[model samples]
Target: MAKTNLKTATAKQRIFRKAINLLNQIFFTWNNGNEEELVSFLQTIRDKSPNVQFQKLIASSVPFLNAFVQNQNSNLFSRIYRHPFIQGYSLPYEVGNTKLVHSDWLRSVLIRAVCYCSSVEDFNLERIYLELTCLTNGYSLRFVETHVQHFFNFFHLHPMRYSRDQIMYNKFRHNWFNYIKIQHELSDQLQQFDDKGQLIHLNYLYEYGAR
Candidate 1:
């Protein structure tokens, strides 16, 4: 058997490694939760920057990203997994009541929003799926269910009218599901809590079952 040098490092490999290091230092450091630090860093990079699209991507995803970082427990790299900026958002509604799902238009918006956010960041897809299913604004579970139903309806009705890459934004008094989902899932994992601060579980909410 001959000894193989497959594991040996090369100049190109080193170059790529250094490039990634520089990219992270320049682009991903802002993902750190210190808002003030991030703002200051953004100001510094405002003029001479790399990939302006990255800026746009970060700008668009910031709100959800901030929410995930604020709520979750993890460092910058780990938090990117469930970066709320990449997981999308839902309408604030009550839980347990089925009436809210009636607005099909809104439900679809939520679905599209979640999809859009997930597409923006490089994160674990399974985590994103689970979080989007379980995440909400601390409103009612039943109301959230209704919102999901409404979101599905919107997606179904539109069918081919909208592009898969487009966010399901609403207007003209359609379904009220406005906020979009983020591009990544959170690392802390999603915990369901009721108004009384009791732990609860509602996996069935986003399951798109025989509807």
Candidate 2:
């Protein structure tokens, strides 16, 4: 009976390790624009039994998984500390500060939108922009719309209005809005492909900068 218990513990550890590695691969794909392999890997991880504790890993992996999944452009953990929505939503309200309210609405909205960006190619730059705009207090559709306009203007594309800028909305209705501007920006900024149009190093930039 003791041996069986030991084996069970060992199995859980293995699950934990693989889940951690999968999360790392997801992060690398997002930052480095390696979608094909990441999609395949994500599918494999998703196919694992729902009872395997993958969701639990995401919740418990702390600084690592949070950094891996959250705002990759910013230090993910740092944003959690200062973000207005998080500040509005975090627990342990001060006594007599009954004005405080904690709600998961903003986080849920952001996560669902991110999941819509399934591939590196499909991941739109506006998704990040809208997410940042939405995390602030009393964020209006106009606030998100302003960034959408700026994004398009930067690319010399026609700006989208608040109603047409759907990435700010919940995921189900946030379908493509003929917003080719975002796709162009992502393609232009893709790190793996160089100016001369060649595939660059997966890890070279990190090593080169470390020297």
Candidate 3:
């Protein structure tokens, strides 16, 4: 019984070690972009583990997580990617959720679409899809329009859909890195405040019945 248990434990450890090594290789391939190395690594994986499968790039484009990455003329571009199987599905029903929840969800998704889409055309396409999804899920036209406008305003862009300029969008994308840096600085400042006991952390729950 002891020997059997030891063998089972050793097998599990070996599987875990292999999984970690595979993840490291994947990350290295992603960062380095060595096609030949990736091909060889994938072939080895397939030979060693027939059950594991990988989808190869098609037409220099591949879907990764929620975005589609494309290599075009030595330049890399990306946009929001939706699975074909779930293309017909609507977002969470607006009527079933609180207004705050709906607003937050819409804003978050719009932000993601903006960040992921590298071109104006892709962004506009995603925007239209989001609008249709929200509308089909019982969101009011006015509400959708308001939030969409607010998103444009937050990024200091023209609110009109047709007025979206590629130059302006590119400028916004360039400035986004600076915005992230500022956010990191603010986080560090907050951490300093916490360390100095100058900031208070509060956790409170609102009681709807009391309200």
Candidate 4:
């Protein structure tokens, strides 16, 4: 029969399915087979709440928010997830939206693709998907190419369509130290404005009696 499993880390809870003899059994433990009682104890409090609901999935892979997580041999992997209906849909480039909006949107999508995909192959697929989506939404070819190139540069990867070197990709993948270092550097650089100090605040003031 199908079994449900719940893994909790900090504030996030991920639920997946596994096949076992126990029917409708739910495991609330880690890979080490501990913490089942802690989760069960917490469940009592949740049961007292009327607004909360519990859901179970019967698949090895499930989509949780913007990421698709897969359970392989009890190990969890994740990748970017986009709904089919919303594919290729974004604020059209030809619209009156500011250039910053368009650029920020693309950058955010690329960042999510890089951070979410567990494998280089999955990242390449997400890159292609983003390229097509941007093109279909009227983003300029050069605009997309330049931003995508910057994304690779941010990761210190060769700006080719795909990296043939798995070693380079592993620096960002399996190595948490290197991955976090690059992310911290990128965050620091992005926060600065035109070689000045980092932006402190942004305020929007309305004209009094002008509405």
The lDDT for every candidate, in the order shown, is: 0.35, 0.36, 0.64, 0.60
Clashing pairs in 2: none
The root-mean-square deviation over C-alpha atoms between each candidate and the true structure, in angstroms, is 18.8, 17.0, 10.5, 10.7
Predicted candidate 3 versus true structure: per-residue lDDT over 1-211, tens digit per residue: 2223323433423221111223422211132336785577557556655655466663677766677777677577788888887756466544643666667777778777767788988888888888887788766888788888877776676543555688877776666647756887999999999999999999864322100
Off by over 4 Å in 3: 1-59, 87-89, 93-97, 191-197, 201-211
Q: Stretches of candidate 1 above 4 Å error?
A: 1-138, 157-211
The alpha-carbon lDDT assigned to residue 148 of candidate 1 equals 48
Over 88-140, each residue of candidate 1 has an lDDT whose tens digit, in order, gives 55443456543345344344544434433333232224324433554444434
lDDT of 4 by residue, 54-161 (tens): 564546787766678777887777788877777355654445435666677777777677667777788888888788777776667887788888767764665434
Please say which candidate is ahead in TM-score: 3 or 4.
3
Candidate 2: count of backbone clashes, pairs at least 3 residues apart or interchain? 0
Q: Compared with the true structure, what per-residue lDDT tens digits does model 2 show for residues 1-211? A: 2223323433423221212233333222122224574355445444543323222233321443333233444333212213334543333334542222212333343433434443322234435544454544344565445544544454243332233334433222233323334665777777546766775655432111000
lDDT agreement of model 4 with the native = 0.60
Q: Mind sharing the TM-score for model 1?
A: 0.21
User: On a 0 to 1 TM-score scale, where does candidate 2 land against the true structure?
Assistant: 0.21
TM-score of 4: 0.60
